[model samples]
Target: VASWAMISNFIDVVKEGRGTFSIQGLGDPSGRGRMISFVKAPARGGDKEAKKPAIIAGTKTDLRRLSMGKAEAILKTLGVPAEEIKLLTRWNRINLIQRLSTAAAADGSKLGDRYGGFA
Candidate 1:
């Protein structure tokens, strides 16, 4: 929930026009698994009130690993400009366990920062 909140807030900031976007998530596990969400930012006040689809993707059922490729795909699907989307991951208890179990456990690439900008 924390990571998703951060991502959603970030997306809201970069989407440009206010009150022009809607955000949603798919594959979210409610209370059990990881939370994933999509941010849809479209131009406002069109000829008609066109509804845009909300793109969705999320972590696997285990909630320990998140695929950057999948995350990128979801952002693309939601029409997020490539240069304006940032990715942030926060580890919960399950993630810590998974990281410790791996023999090659010293990789700190994904742990680079708590906040980053895709721009």
Candidate 2:
């Protein structure tokens, strides 16, 4: 079982950072995989809010390499194992902002189909 401290640490790291990002997975039938890219979101709430947001574009590889790819790279850099990620099945949000906006376009360099069709 995972410890609460580990989970709390992950949350704290994300809270202190500012940016948009993505993680794409690709692999073959054997489950060997590679991740394309993990773009970070643009800096927000600063002196200039007009700057283009930071977004992870995509990289391509065989589906089999998905697990070993970009998403895994992110985890490795965070000193966590790839298998520790738990997929999100639902979302319930509470925010103070009354109106917010999300970027609708993904960078052309990224793959459209594999990563939720952001592009």
Candidate 3:
């Protein structure tokens, strides 16, 4: 399957919860069969009633691979509001950078150019 298609499937799994699914016609030129299993992380603190916000974050290459339009569309199909999608994307990017910075500091290694000079 195309990279974008795989990404879309993953996003769907994240938004709609885990289940067994199939992605046929992938990994072969002849369009053979393929099955995929999606297992979501268990709820933290064993609080089944707890709610978690779904936020998508990725590296620059990942972001480039999955365009904002496609990402927004995927989220919209899952019932996310357009305005919240914008805010979520922005917040996720910022949080990603902050986490990277924190990890770099803890490890005593510079983030370097991999993060677009975010070090």
Highest TM-score: give the candidate number.
3
Instruction: Name the 10 consecutive residues with the lowest summed lDDT in model 2.
Output: 92-101
RMSD list, candidates in order: 23.9, 28.1, 20.6
Best candidate, lDDT: 3
TM-score per candidate: 0.20, 0.16, 0.23
Q: Candidate 1: which pairs clash?
A: none
Steric clashes per prediction: 0, 23, 0
Question: CA lDDT of each candidate?
Answer: 0.40, 0.32, 0.48
lDDT of 1 at 28: 39
Candidate 2: residue 8 lDDT (0-100): 50
Q: Model 1, poorest ten-residue lDDT window?
A: 110-119
The residue-by-residue lDDT of candidate 1 on 3-95, one tens digit each, is 786466556656643432244333334544455334344455345866654322222233324465555443444345656444334333223
Candidate 1: regions farther than 4 A off: 1-64, 86-119
lDDT of 1 at 33: 47
Error of 1 at 91 (Å): 8.8
Mark the regions of model 3 whose C-alpha exceeds 4 Å error after superposition.
1-64, 90-119
| Model 3 RMSD in angstroms | 20.6
lDDT of 3 by residue, 1-119 (tens): 56676566667667665532343333223454433433223335346785644333433333334456665654454345777778766446444444554455466653433343332
lDDT of 3 at 79: 45
